[model samples]
Target: MTEEDWIAHDPDPVTAAELAALDPGERAARFAKPLTFGTAGLRGPVRGGPDSMNLAIVVRATWAVSRVLTERGLGGSTVVVGRDARHGSVPFAIAAAEVFAAQGFSVITWDHPVPTPVVAFAVRHTGAAAGVQITASHNPRTDNGYKVYFDGGLQIISPTDREIEAAITTAPPADQIPRRPVHPADDTLIDAYVTRAAMVRRGDHGNPRVALTALHGVGGELAMRTLRTAGFGDVHTVASQFAPDPDFPTVAFPNPEEPGAADALLQLADEIGADIAIALDPDADRCAVGIPTPDGWRMLSGDETGWLLGDYILSTLDATDAATSVVANSVVSSTLLGKIAADYGARHVVTLTGFKWLARADAELTGFRLVYAYEEAIGHCVDPAAVRDKDGISAAVLACDLVAHSGAQGISITDALDRLALRHGVHTTAALSRRVADAVEAAAMMDRLRADPPAELAGFPVGATVDGDAVFLTGGDQQTTVRVVVRPSGTEPKVKCYTEVGLAVGADLAKIRERAAAVQQQLLATAQSW
Candidate 1:
């Protein structure tokens, strides 16, 4: 469509004016590519172009969502809608709610912003046909996203995402679509979420000091409440980042996994001599952890925290239930969790990299329950039953429980990790990313790797599995076994590589860990050249 057509069809005159003011070349770039539903949902800059996340795109996407639900015989059923504190979040959320209401479904939205997981929980709690959360999670300050959860509270996958894209392509313009005004729902949904999230704590033994930071997102208030309800009252927070701020002035990147994003939290931990630290992503769907070490304060990699939480949860389950429980992680994550699950007589599952796949892992086992799931990107599902998606808030509660249990035994999470390493070998992980000019270049890079697979990576003789999708490289050297998964990034013009190195703990565990980490660095170096 032309700029004039888009401006005429835009429901909001403000964004329409923004679109109208663009010059020809600028307009061409804005309309270069329309946003497609992928990597969970629609995410982009909240701007006024058809390609950007404006009212025109949101309205059409919601119409498609409503149509998809209605096609499945779910018309007129309740659908929960919510948003986080971000640019255009309020209007986008209200527009989505009204679209659902006009499409003949009951709409429930919040008066204030909320974490992404709360929207997932509210979906399952209220038996809503679906849920929509307007958030960007850990993305930059200028971005926003739309995530949809079905009745089970897991993000939609497969043909559903594809179908929505097709429907959006043919959907009517925003101004032509009908919408009914919808009011915010009561806050009982938030209360229910807090109560259930606090139930993830498995122990009540020791008092450990805790420090947390929300990174200027909307999770601080509820995270504190959940911790307080779980009997872990000794908590301190990074005051500057505790409140919701869309600008995210304190950190260059809002993601806790990014370097220096958790600096303030660690500094506060050192100041308070806290037993543990928690860093929640902007929307509180991912959690990164920090702990004091003999050397200094250190933040655990997502995989290390995964091992600790996996071992702790498995150790606490009833023996009877252990046999019927499952722990899961993505294909590219460290394999140590599988070893821990095996030691506990439980099963482990490796799925495509996303919570949509990890959250639904139990379906494959029929009768088994998904006890836990973690991705190397600091996403954890400590209480999948309460909320099928990755929930940093619930994961924080569980992390505190693990800290309390370790403190009662006069041990630390570091000691716990060491024990796991001694039993299952040291697992070190890192990533290699190569940015290209565009997705086409990224695809060519992946295609070249698939056509001529590497015989060895980082000096280890390697074996490759070149499926049409991603390339998985595995090999073993004298000191370590290196595993790597390479694919193109979903949101950027780059190819991403995830590498992990494993070595059996020898007489000197520290030396073995160092060797493994060195191998990881070499593996990343080799992958970078691809």
Candidate 2:
């Protein structure tokens, strides 16, 4: 069927009886097709229709994954399972584990919810064949997800993602599948995670006045424990969101990067004069920071935070003479690490925008200690020695430590960013998205751009075009980018565009920013026409 036809079809295509049984919105939501697993895994609303993520879908995915693993001679292998505090996540984790155990795989399940990255860590540390995490990362509360990690606790990337998805698309009969009871193993991995996270702390402060929120998800208790263990004191918790609530009662979007998502924490920060406000996603894998700025409680952009943490990690490494290398996702703002690498005379590399790529690269490469790897999405991987995956808990501790170091030097994160921009060339990035009619349309649009791309944008000559399903980098160094990358929404009917603009390394920050802003307008216009 054509792209137009797919979008025009009724989402539910259900009978009158089923339609009558649900609210209008509910019916519509149910009708829409939930996404299947991708390279990054499955994510969508928990209560949506046949396609949405729910107990049934989770089980189906688990069964499918198990079947594929069994066929690959991995049936008896141990599988590590973890979950965040998203609504229905624990049950989903248990469901997945039960399915895996019933399929005859040994299961090591966490007793309490933990960050997504910890699941990846456990997989590698425990020598499990694969891992599964119940989380939607930074998605809205209505959403929950299932992310799979293969051997080495790395995200299942291309070719492999396709292989696993093909197996899922052709699932065996549900009746033939057996549902097993999930038994939780004695998981000491969480403690190991905490110990490594604590290593991110630098100075001793007895304890810092910290304000934390689970955001009505799973981060609050574990985060507080880690902070306290790291010698941070006076941890103030947000009253309403202190507990895990799948509904995410207090926030519109569960992600901390969105505007006003940190409003409550910022207000509390003002009242208590806390050192910093740390917010985790529903899954506690991605983190956001809200620190006091001269302009008010200004939340640092993910790029800004990544830059700060990268600088701190590099600086600490220099003092300790630790053998380390730096890595980042292709989409992140490179305001620090490149120069830092130049200073240390180490290697720096960029991968496609996912931990799957990062972790796999880490295992494949050698002589390069990966001190840190982060993307602008607030996903950070610290302690490459411990967990070769993004660990929000570690990131939070490192953020606290970075703040402490800055405090001792009488500087703020904003000032740190300014200094980095001054040292490296100022870099700015923006992402814009359009809700397409369906996947087919999105694909067709991308194909068209690939075939006959624009020659220029807003009078800036198109330097080049890098077209991948998940990445598109346009323009060259020294020339401000008029770039547009197109990627289908892993969980929704949207095509995301990542636009970036960078001036020469020595260009004036303010003037380059203005020019980049103007270029971005033209880039968006070009993209809309596509």
Candidate 3:
């Protein structure tokens, strides 16, 4: 169909007006290519055309999803559909539910907005054949998405993703697809998930004063309830961000990892003298942490959170469980997790970036359970068996426990980090990222970096370089291991340069960390030029 035809049949008036406002060339440009799935699902700006997020695309995509599942003999099975409060999310989700219902499948969904984890959890809880969640997570305000989870409550991967993409490309047009209005199910499953999240932490360490923020998304209500249920009574939420607001007015970006994203939370934490602060992304799939320091308040790098949580969770593991369990992190994350896994006798696997890969660690390793998995981008799957994806609510509950336990010992989390450093070497990590106009620019940038990499970086000679979808540079300087990986983000329009400085722990732990930070900055600067 032509662009004009798409506009004529477009279901949403907003997108229809958007298409009518654009010039013929610009409007046609959007139709030059169809929407494609990245990582697990289709995410793009919500606008007119098949290349973006709209009711028509959502309908077609759901039709494709239905087709793929039916081919696997899952016809007439259940499909769980959900949405966040982003622009166009509600209608997109409704359109998807219509497709599933029209296809004669049992549809399970919620009347209200829910976090990304709930959809993932409910899929398993309901014994559904597939799940669909309309969320863009922490992307900019104008963006939206359609995410899919399969039978095992795991994000779709590899051949399955490709199959869905193929079906989406060849599926019927939106107007031709029939949809039925369906009633949403009760919240029993969501309630069950919150209760389960509360149980991820162990023994009752007294509830220390906690500060939290949902970054103006759907996680606020659920996160607060889960933490309180986990015995963390002294919780304070940033009131301005406690409610679900699609615009995310308080911060320049909704992501907790972005600079200044947690500014309001830090101020609140400092004012309340809170023991720890937690920031959950818009969809609550990723969790970022902050703690008090002698130098005032500061957010811990995702790596720091990973190390602390990894240590705490592993410490709770029994000998039998630890022996047969697996831990995995993205290759770009700090290598400290691998060493920690070794100390605990747990298998560690370094998968490609994205939680989609991290979620499949146990499946890849036969006869092993995946106890923990994390990515340095503020994502943690502490309860993989329950959620099968990064769950900010569970991570927040467990982080509170970590702080509470440390307080009971009459020490701060910083002291816990010092102990970790003393056992494992000091691992300092930093990133240098470059934004691009589109994937084409990102590809050109990667090619340029790979064609002429520096002979040395931050005083470490280039000992070896591994080239593929990403480039890995490894070398050493004065017993410190220098590691760097440059790759295009699977979910965004940018190329990320992840750098780490590994140095031996010394008598002056602070002094050792200072050296590592300086080296990491130098490495980041070097990577910036690439």
Q: Which of the two candidates, 1 or 2, achieves a greater lDDT against the reference?
A: 1
Cα RMSD to native, each candidate? 1.4, 5.2, 1.3
lDDT of 1 by residue, 267-339 (tens): 9999999999999999999999999999999999889889999998999988889999999999878999999
Question: Ranking under TM-score, best-scoring first?
Answer: 3, 1, 2
Residue-level lDDT tens digits of model 2 in 393-464: 878888887887787778877778777777766666666668788788888877776777766666666644
Each prediction's whole-model lDDT (CA): 0.90, 0.72, 0.90
Question: Could you estimate the TM-score for every candidate?
Answer: 0.97, 0.85, 0.98
Segments in model 2 whose C-alpha atoms lie over 4 Å from true places: 1-35, 47-50, 110-112, 169-171, 205-208, 319-324, 332-336, 444-448, 451-454, 470-473, 476-484, 504-530
Q: Least accurate stretch of 10 residues (summed lDDT) in model 3?
A: 460-469
Pairs of residues clashing in candidate 1: none
Shift of residue 84 alpha carbon in model 2, Å: 3.1
Q: TM-score: which is higher, 2 or 3?
A: 3
Q: lDDT score, residue 114, model 1?
A: 93
